[model samples]
Target chain A: MRRFSWFNATSLTLGFAFLYMPMVILIIYSFNESKLVTVWAGFSTKWYGELLQNEAFLSAAWVTAKVAVASSTIATVLGTMAAYVLVRAGRFRGRTLFSGMIYAPLVMPEVITGLSLLLLFIGIGLDRGVMTIILAHTTFSMCYVSVVVSSRLVSFDRSLEEAALDLGCSPFEAFRLVTLPIIAPAVISGWLLAFTLSLDDLVIASFTSGPSATTLPIKIFSAVRLGVSPEINALSTIMIGIVTVGVITASLISKRASLRLQAEEQAAART
Target chain B: MRRLLLISVPYLWLLALFLVPFFIVLKISLSDTALAIPPYTPTLDLGAGWAGLKGFFAELDLENFWFLTTDDLYWKAYLSSVWIALFSTLLTLIVGYPIAYGMAQAREEWRPTLMMLVILPFWTSFLIRVYSWMGILSQEGVLNQFLMWSGVISDPLMILNTNTAVYIGIVYTYLPFMILPIYAALEKLDISLIEAAEDLGCSRFQAFWLVTVPLSKNGIIAGCFLVFIPALGEFVIPSLLGGSQTLMIGKVLWEEFFNNRDWPVASAVAVILLLILIIPIILFQRNEQKQREAEG
Candidate 1:
């Protein structure tokens, strides 16, 4: 057993404290009764109420949600297909370029991606709107989705897919029935990742979005640039709450699933 | 046919969106600025055939590239961005290594929860994370208030909207990128190797230096690249936290495009930025390739 030294304990504690302190402060300040974000007053939910009432913020939220759903869904399908091809397709022409495109965007700067995509839209005479934002989000987030799905695909048992094929199932049917179900968890996680990425993106969205559409990040960015406000604190708290719940729930579900699988395997061994 | 269909769908999507847009940026960078809607001249006219091609080729020049060279702002921004990225990447590594080592040495069952704690903030809004610092780092904000109360300082520190704040934001945000890869590497390390080193008359520090550090070199390389590459082109942290004096190329590119509305110049900036990035990017890719090969 590795001994846990005081040094390790201190480092871990300080590290986590550093990681979360700003967020904790922001969350606490969200309910400040005073308009000043930094000043303390008696706790109140006025900012939340005002946030709910702000039509612009609400509409921006609506647009963001719409974009997230549309983009992530399409990204998931396309990314899954990309992952399938990368793992299953053997020595096709331009294989190196195919994989290069897959990995390059993961590390590519958002400013570059956004700039290039905007120029493409303008050059092609495409109207910049919610549709353009969706296309841009789909293009980048699909790379993330493919990354997530492909890691799982790499470890997938090929024989199960082969067995389905041998049982008179067509290739498409085999994939739809056997491979899809088995990789559903990865695909779902990929979708979630894509969704969060789209939601969190401000730079790309700022470049691609027209006057017709604005995302929540863009709204928050413009507001925050004028300095911190109590309303933004409230919004941040709400966003943090949603993400905390989502991530915790996801980890819990995956944990429970693995535990159940372990128990089932142990029981089968006894039998 | 089925196999071909599966490959081509994604292959073509990436070609049209990713590859073609990149080429367009390259093309625009070589063109002259215009007052028209798209803001660049010599748009390809296939209708004019070979003559049009000749005209387009004639119009294209390295004028914008020359313009970038003449301006001190462009080169200075590039240099400062590289310097800032290098500095912050070092800072992230310093802060992250101990945390990652601590996690690797932690109790087995606590590892997952610890990992999740690190990732939870990542899943949250990045803008919010950067924005959250404003309330703490401002002149009259929490840090100053606390420091004053603790008698650590007599006056409020001017941190927000400064290069210092940009450093803080970059280190805070990219710390996770550094920690994860290092943690993965440290976790896979054989403790017995360190034990053997200690048993063979090496001191604890020497054992760590000889065994642990060398073993985790690949992780260190991966983590450094992960932090460095993104930090080099980071837009958000600098734009929000950095003052007007802060000169990051990403911010420069953004202002040139949106604020100045100079598409050709902006494209040239981006092209240069991409050129600067290509070296590190290729190194990162090669590192990833080597890691994969080692694992396989």
Candidate 2:
């Protein structure tokens, strides 16, 4: 008769604690005045201030942003196309091959992807930098985008597109007027996912990045490798802060949108 | 023309950037090592026509693959990577399944927030999460300090730079991958089915074992592969948290490339790793295909 069992409650609590405890500790200790990470010598915002002044970290952040923006945009476009082709392009030659490439990157190890792309650049005598990094990120992240968009495409109403085409809309116009609008949300989500994947990447960036194209993750990894610094903790806390705000805002917006849609549906039913 | 253009956009992008690069890695895996810029001989310089192709073919050999066979360390690193990855996948599933099931059964309003928490860490920098563990598990880290302060132990534990830390890091990082898929499967389960089973004299535990476990098998498999594949090639976690003693294939590939500057052997390691992963990759794709067919 118990709905929320004690077992489930315990597991959820323990799992969440396990997940968040380390991050919480890291964030709290980032505020410590002491240079030593373990011993607290009163709280201060000095680490955050120091982080802002660190030119290397700032440049890395800038480079990361640039690569993320570029790669995600490119990935979204190509991925949407790929998803549409897979869903609509009937009996296309080499369909198996196309789908294989799409799914391969989703499960491909970052190390292998990184190494392969690095070798490709070297084989062709191309320079390694932000551009090459963008290429590498786009190659991997497009698989994610395709997966997201294709799921949406699968459940989409075919009649809507048929009606648009029957009403004298060209095929492209039918797609633009009907299909694209409906799938826009999925595509947007795909783009955001790709953006984060690019932003969060370390191995691929490290492999492909040349001089003057260090990413935030690469820089952070090097710093952490050398030793744990309070500044790194401060930076991580800020990153967590940004992610929390973004996720909250996204969920709220989606919740409101779904509620509005339900209300509209109810009104339509009443009429 | 439009269809062609639409298809070719992604197809060509992937062909150029993804597929071609893999072939290049395959090619590089065969070539000999060098000390010059680019650091490998017998470049596949196709622009130079047939003569260049002939030269490239002439320089290619199985030397790097042979080198891998001769080195015991490479074999150990690879076997250890697979061993660690498999165990961690099981661990992630054990820790993640209950949380995912709880989230599925939670109030509809609460489910989204719970899912968001699972995904939020994924959005944060992966390296930072690994770095957070370094702080917790180090000899003089917060964990040891707390235990010492509480009089739990007189001496600090050597948790960092060990295989245990690697497992902890992998499980922590990849837990969401296990959770999300299982939650997706569990969320779609019909409450009526469980009720039906209960009415048939099946206890709740039996109902769960017979009904839930059987139903969620696909998700479990998918989630395991999701955790296992990347965990196999996880360079960052092993390198950052694990010591030199932890011999993961990723770390070995990295050392061979950067420290030894042996691109051919590194590529060979990667090629072998990919060959090993191909089985799981194929199985994952087939599972996805079966799901799609079922949905249709």
Candidate 3:
């Protein structure tokens, strides 16, 4: 057996505390009742009520929700199509370039991305608004979606596709009818991924977005410069709750599907 | 064969939107800083330029490109960004490795739960999380309140609006980015290899060093890049946390382009920033290619 020492215990405690202490503090203070952030008065949810009634923040959040939905929806289809092309298009000229192009944003600095898009819109004389923000968000988010979709695309059984074509169905029909169902989940997850990315983004949104096109993040950022209150913590706790529930649900669904895949494989072997 | 064109359409869309935008940035960066509406004067003439193109490319200049190095503030910001990014990445590794190891060692069923825990932050808005740190670390905030409540000090500690806050903010936001890839790497590690090391009379530490650490190096590298690259250009964290004291390249770039409206200088800074990052990016791609080849 490995040796257990006091030093090890201390270090582990420090490590765990370092990882979780801030989050603990944030959650605890979310319930602070007083407007005075320094003092511990009591507990309340008034800040949440305040958040609900704040029309400016609510509308900005609504705009953010709309952008996430529209951009992610567009990105899912485009990204899946891009992945299909990348995976199914075969080795050809510009394939390397095409792949590199998709990944450029992954490593490219956000300042560059934001600047380039800003300059592009200005040069084209296009008005800066939600439309521009949506376009920019989709550009980077689509790369992420494509990468995810194509990984699953690589693991797919090609013979199933080939067999469908042999059974008197056109290539498009075969893909639409056969391949779509198997890969549709990846596409949906890609959309979720895109939605999260769009929601999280601030720099790209800041650059392309006009004064009227404020995202929740941008709004929070501007408000935060004045100093943070418990209201921000309350907002975070709610966000954490939503995201935690979403991720747990996804993990459960994924676990079920993987188990089902294994069981089907085993049953096939028995046959 | 006819199906190939259908496949190509998606890429064409990216080329038109994504690629074209950068191409335009490249174009504007090459042009002279004029007082035109777009504030660009197209030369299309290099005048025996760096690339030595005559008619089609004579409008570009190496003046703005070479002129960037002369600015002391720009270099200072660059150095500051590099320092912050490196330190934050190092801090993340120190904190993340143990959790990754624990998660990797857990039962298969438990591993997914741990992974979901790490990824739960990503599902929420990062902007909110960073802002959450701002609240926690501010002078009159919970951190100070708690410290004072415990009678640990006579007065509140002035922690906010400093370089320390910038580091805290960055690590808070990026810790999961560092953790996930490492956890993914550690999970796929072969248990038998570690067992073999143990059977050969190696201690747990030795087993980790000899068997586990080397195996997960790719994940470590990927995790470092994932944090470092973004942190290098991070704006929101430094801007909010550092206030006026923190000067990073990203903030400088923002001030130059947006605040001062100096488009040419901003693009010049961007060009240099891209040039600096290309080597590391290429190395990252090469490693990714090697990993893919091994897996394939």
Give the candidate number with the greatest TM-score: 1
By DockQ, is 1 or 3 better? 1
Grade the docking of candidate 1: high
Error of 3 at A7 (Å): 9.3
Q: Rank the models by TM-score, top first.
A: 1, 2, 3
**In model 3, what is the error at residue A24, expressed in angstroms?**
4.4
Name the candidate that leads on DockQ.
Answer: 1
lDDT of 3 by residue, B134-246 (tens): 66777777778788889998798877888888888887778788878887888788788888899999997899898889999988998888888888888888888886868
In order, the Cα lDDT scores of the candidates are 0.93, 0.90, 0.80
Can you write out model 2's per-residue Cα lDDT over A1-271, one digit (the tens) per residue? 1247788889889999999999999999999999999888999999999999999999999999999999999999889989999898988889999999998888788888888888888777788999999999998998999999999999998998998988999998998888987787788889989998998999899899998699999988888997679999999999989878876787677667767767886997899
Model 3 Cα shift for residue B254 (angstroms): 1.2
Cα shift from native, residue A148, model 2 (Å): 0.9
Q: How do all models score by TM-score? A: 0.98, 0.95, 0.90
Question: Candidate 1's residue-wise lDDT over A1-271, tens digit each?
Answer: 2658999999999999999999999999999999987789999999999999999999999999999999999999999999998898878889999999998888888999999999999988999989999999999988989998999999998998999999999998999998997688889899999999999999999999999999999999999998989999999999999999998898788778768867886997899
**Per-residue C-alpha lDDT of model 1 across residues B1-296, encoded as one tens digit per residue:** 98888899888989988999999999999999999877889899999999999999999999999999999999999999999999999999999999999999999999999999998888989999999999999998999999999999998999998999999999999889999999999999988999999999999899989999999988899999999999999999998999999999999999999999998999999989989999998998789889989998
Q: Lowest summed lDDT over 10 consecutive residues: which window, candidate 3 chain B?
A: B43-52
| lDDT, ranked from best to worst | 1, 2, 3
Each candidate structure's count of clashing pairs:
0, 0, 7
Which candidate should be chosen as best, given lDDT against the real structure? 1
